[model samples]
Target: MTNETMMQYFEWYLPDDGKHWQHLAEDAEHLKAIGITKVWLPPAFKGTSSNDVGYGVYDLFDLGEFEQNGTVRTKYGTKADYLRAIASLKEKDIVPISDIVLNHKANADAKERFAVVKVKPDNRSETISEPYEIEAWTQFNFPGRQDKYSDFKWHWYHFTGVDYDALHDETGIYMILGDNKGWADSENIDQELGNYDYLMYDDIDFRHPEVQEHLKYWADWFLKTSGVGGFRLDAVKHIDKVFMKDFIRYVRENLKEDLYVFGEYWKDSNSDIVQYLEATDLQFDLIDVMLHMNFFEAGEKGSDFDLSTILEDSLMKSHPDFTVTFVDNHDSQRGQALESTVAEWFKPLAYGLILLRQEGTPCIFFGDYYGISGEFAQTGFQDILDKLLYIRKYHVYGPQEDYFDHPDCIGWTCLGDEKHPDGLAVVMTNGEASSKRLNMGELNRNKVFVDYLNNCPQEVVLDEAGWGEFPVQAASISAWVNKETHLSS
Candidate 1:
C-alpha cells in the first residue's frame, strides 16, 4: 500500500499521573479534526510503581487498575475507560494502537525470578538475571540522569557501585546487565551510572520455551481483547532474532488480520537494517532510523541530502513492500531538537516521497502535525500535520511497482500507472531548481500541471517540437497528474 492509502497514526503518551477518561476522550476528537486515523497510546498495563512513563512493567494484566490514583475514576481512568477511548477513536474512524514493551520487566518487585548470582562470575561478571541498575532514562534516576533507575530495592537484589558482570545462563545464552554498560554508548554510562541505581532486575531468557509461551499468551490476549490494528515493538534489537521470528509467527497465526508490526532498530545503514527484516516472517515492517538520520543531516548542517532518492534506493534495493518511512520519532526529535522549524515546508516533500514511493509503508510522525510547542516544543514537534495529511489524502497516489528516479539532481518521480500513458506522477527536488523535458512522440495536447505547493497554476503548452519544461524549486516538492488521468474523488 502507498503511504497515502494507509491510515496515518500519531504516537501519543498519556501521563500516568495526569488526566482521566474524559481528557482522553476529548483528545480523540482533537486527533480526528486534524485527520489522524490512529493514535499509538503507551502501555496501559499497571507498572511496579507510579513511574509516569509506562514502560516499567509490573502486572501485564492490571491495565493500571490497582495504583494510587488508578481506581478507574482518577487520572488515566479505568480499563473500561481505555476501551471507551478506543471506541471513541473508532467513532472518528481512527484506530488506537497500544505501545507494548515486551523486552524486560520492572526492577521493583518482579513477579518472575530468573536467577541471581550469589558469587559474582568472572569475564562476564557484569551480567545479571534482572535489570536492577537504573540508567539515566528511567524515572528513578537522579535529576540529571533520568534514564537509569533501579527496578528493585537493595534487599531483593545485589547492588554494586561498579558495573555488574555480564552473565551466561546454563543454556549458554549471554544476558547483559541493564546498567550503563548495557547501553550503546560509554558516555551515557559515565554520566548516568550511580551507586543507588546499581540493583538489576529480570531480563527474560528468550532461548527458554516458557518465556516464549509467556509472550504468546499476552500477544493473544492483547489482540483478542484490545482490538488494536498493529504493534510497535519496543527494543527489538535487544532480543534474540530467533525469538522475534517465532513471536511474529505466533502473533500472525493467532490474530489472522492485516496486522502491522514495526521495530525501533536505531541505525541508518541499509545493509544493517536489511538483516532484521529478513530474520522474521514479520520483522519490523517499517523502520524510522534512516529518515531520522536524513532529518538530522538536513536540519542541523543544512546538508543537501536527497531524502527522496535515499528512500527510493532503500525500498527498491533492500527490503521492498515492507518498510516504514518517517521524518522524526519521539526519541531523536527530543534530543537534537530543531529550532528554526521548517515542518510545514518539509512535510509536503517527505509525504510526497513516502506516499508516492512503491517500496515501503509510510508512517507519519505524530508531533509533526500537532504543533507541540513550549518545553515539549523541543521534544515534540508536529507543526505541519494537518497540511501533510490533507495532501496525503487528496493529492498522492497509492504505491505501485514502477518508480522513476533522477538521483543525480536529488529528485525522483513515482508513476501510478504507466501502460495507458496517462497517470499521476509525483516529482520532488531537494535544494536545487532544474527543468526536464520528456519526449512524448504521439502524446500531444496534454494539459500542463502544477503541484499543490505551487501558488499559481503554471501551464506548459507543447509546441510542434514536442518539448515541455518542468520547473522544480529548491528544497521543495511538487506533484503532477496527466489531466486525462485525474481521479474524480
Candidate 2:
C-alpha cells in the first residue's frame, strides 16, 4: 500500500511523565487496536541540567541517563526502558519515529574553545600575537570557569534581531568578532539561540566535512540501536541548506528503508513551503500554517469562514507530494468553543476534507484520537480514534474522485472502482437545513446505502436525487456509502 493510505500513528510525548511507562505501553496497544502503523515520539536523548522537554542535548549517546531519583537513570528511564517501549510497539507492527536535534549543543560547561579570555581591560589590540593563546579566566564576572569553555571557539549568529559582531575575514583557524553588538539586543537572545533555552556550546561548522561524518554517525547509531523507522528533522531553516541536502542524501543511502524524514519548515506561505519541499526529500507532508488557518481557524472563526477560498486556491496550486496535512498540531489549536472542547464531533468534517482530497499525505494528530485532557484539554484524542481508523481502513485507500464545495454545501465522492460503480459520498453544510440533490446519476437505482456516523440506513435513488438533511447546528459533517453490488443490482 502507498504511504498515503496507511494510518498515521502519532503520540505527542511518549513517556511524557517519567514514570508512565505502563501508561505508554497501554497507549501503544490502543493505537494498535485502531490500525495505527507508525508512532512519533519526542526526543529520547540526554538533555541539559533540567529535563527541559528533551531537546537540550548534553550527550546524544547517553539518552537522558542522569544520576537523579536514586540513580534510576534517565528522565524517561534507562535505555532498556526505551527498548522495551519500542519492542512493545513493534509487536503491534507500529513503526517508531524519533525526534532528533542536530543543529547545536548545550552551553553549560562548554568545552575550552568557547571560553572568552581576559586581555588587559583597556587593550585595543586588533590582532592577538598568538591567536591560539589562552589568557587568564578573569574576562567576565565569573572567574576560574575554564572547564566551561568548549573545545572550539563559538560564534553567535544574529537571531531575533540581535546583531553580533559580523565576521569580516578568517584569522588563522577561527573567525574573529569585533565586539558584542550591545546588551539591549542580547536580553532574550540566548534562549532563541539554542534548542531548549540554553546557550549553544558551539555553532556546528556544517561546511566542515567532519561535521557531516559526525551527523551520519548519530543517524546510523539511532537507526541501528533504537530501531527507529523515521526522523523528524528539527530546525532546518537555521542550518545551512547545503548541509541539509547532503545530510538527507546520506541518511537515505545509509538507513535501511526509504526512511521518512519530515523537516520543520515553518513557513506561512505555500511558496516558502515549496522551496523546502524541493530541497528536502519529504519535509512535513503537511503545511502546518495552512492547516491551522484552513481547518482550525475556519472552525474557530465559524463555519462560514471567508478564508476557505484562499486555502483551496493555495493547496490546489502547491506541490502535492510532500504536503503533510492536518487540522491542529502540538503548537497550535483552531476550532470552535464547543468543538474545540469536544474534538470528536469535529473530525468527520476535518478528516472528511483532508483524507478525501488529494493534495498531500494526511497526518492525524495524536490528540485527535486519544482524547487529551488537563494541559491538552482541547484535544479529544481517544474520542475519535476508532472512527478515524475505520475511515482510514475503509475510505481513504479507495479511488478518490471529484471534490466540490458550494457556498452552503461541501461534498466529495470516492469510488470503489470504475467498472463496479460502488462508492462513498460525504456532504457537509455550513448553513440552514436543506435537502440537496447530489449528482450521482451513475450509481445504480435501489442500492441500499448507510450513513456511517449516524448509523442511519437509506437507499440510493439514481436520477431521482438522494435526500440529505443539514443539522440545525449550522455546520456538521455526514457520510454515506453504497451497500449493494452493481452487478447484483
Candidate 3:
C-alpha cells in the first residue's frame, strides 16, 4: 500500500471572501496528485461573523446556510459549496475530516440574568467574588435558523461559565451558578491554570443532560448532512472526557463505524497526553504536540540542540499509532495565540524527520505549503515540500534503520520492500556538513543513490555490503533515493 499523507486544507490567514470551498473543489485533483490521502478542513459552521475563523462558533447548525451573524456564507462558503467540496475530495479517494469545535459557544443572541461568581484568572478553581446576579450573553436563540433543524435553544442554565458579564459591564471568568453546573472532573482534564475547563466565550456544560443530548443529536445531524468521513475534534483537553469518549463511540457506532476521529489535545507533555488517552480509553488519535515542540526547540537552538533526542518524550515515540505528527499548524503559525513557529531555516530538516521516517503519520500544514496571507504574509516551501511529498508517497517504505549517533547530524534508511524496491536514505545536519554511513541492507547491494531533494548535488554508490555514506549540507536535509528508480519514475 502507498504511504498515506494528510494535509490541512486551510490556513489561519485565508481571505474572508467565502471562496475557500470553491478553491478546495478546484484543487481536489491537485491535492490528490500530490499524494494527500486525507484533508482536515476548517470549521464548516458559522462563526461570530463572516470573517471569524470558525473557532468563535456561534451556531452549530449554521454551516453557512442561514443569515445568522450578519452573513449567509462563512469564511469558507455556503453549505452547498461545503458539501460539494467534500464530494470532490471523496471523488478523488481523499477522506475529508471536518473540524469540530464543541467546547464553547460564542456570539450569543441575547443576554440573560444569571447568578455567577468570578474566578481568578490564574487559577480558575478559586472564586474571586461571591455569587451575584449578572446579565451574561449566554442565550443562543439562533434567531435566523428559527429552530429549523432542532428546536433546542441554549440558555445560561445549559452552560457552566461565561467570560463577559453584560449586566455589570465586567469581563472575567464567571462560573455559572445553577442546580448541577460546574467544571468537569479535574482528574479527567489537564491540570493547567488550576482547572482548564473554561476556554473561551460561554463554556458548554457537558454535564447537563440536555446539552449532552443536543450535542449528540447535532453530531448525528452533522455527519448525515455533511458526508464527511471523519472529525478533527478541537479543544479536547478542555472538554468533559467522559462525554467526549462516549460521544465519539456513539458517533462511530450509530453513524459510521469507520469514521476517523482525532482530537487537538494541544499539550507538550507526553505524560499529559497519555493521561488523556488513558482517560478516554484510547478510542481516538491525538496531534503529537511534543514532537512539534521538539522541532521548534531544535530550530531555535540550531547546532546546540541535540538532534539525537528529537524523538524522546514524544507521542510519536511512546504511542505511534495514536500520533498525528505535524511540524506546524494554524495555531502555531506566526501572530497566533499559541505561536511557536519553527525556524524556517530548519524546516527542511524537520520535514525530513517526520516525512521520511517510519513513525507517526505526518500532516503537512497549509500555511507551510500554500503560504500565509494577510498581516503576517510569508512565502511557502512549496518547491521542496512537493519533492518530499513525492518521495514519501513513492519511496518511503520497509524496515527502518537509525543512525542518530551524532548530536550535530543524524540519518536513517528504509530497507526496500518487494513492492517498493531501492529503499531511501535520509540525512540531516544542524551545525555543519556531515555524512553518515547507513546500512541499506544486503538486498540493496551495489545500488547507486542520489539526493532526491537535490540539496546535495552528488551521488553515493552502495558497496557490496549495502553500506553507503550519505552527505548533508549544513542546516539542511538530504533524502537519498535509488538513482535509477528516481529517474525512471
CA lDDT, candidate 3, residue 33: 93
Candidate 2 is scored at a TM of 0.71
For each candidate, what TM-score against the reference?
0.69, 0.71, 0.99
Candidate 1 similarity to native, TM-score: 0.69
Give the candidate number with the greatest lDDT.
Answer: 3
Poorly placed runs, candidate 3 (over 4 Å): none
Model 2 RMSD, rounded to 1 decimal: 8.9
**Which candidate leads in TM-score?**
3
354-473, model 3: which lDDT tens digit per residue?
Answer: 888778778999999988877888789999999999899888888888888999988899886888877899999998998999989888789889999898999899999999999999
CA-lDDT, candidates in order: 0.49, 0.50, 0.90
Better of 2 and 3 by TM-score: 3
Off by over 4 Å in 2: 2-16, 20-22, 49-51, 66-75, 111-203, 281-288, 306-317, 333-348, 379-381, 418-422, 434-436, 439-445, 455-473, 483-489
Q: How accurate is candidate 2 locally (lDDT)?
A: 0.50
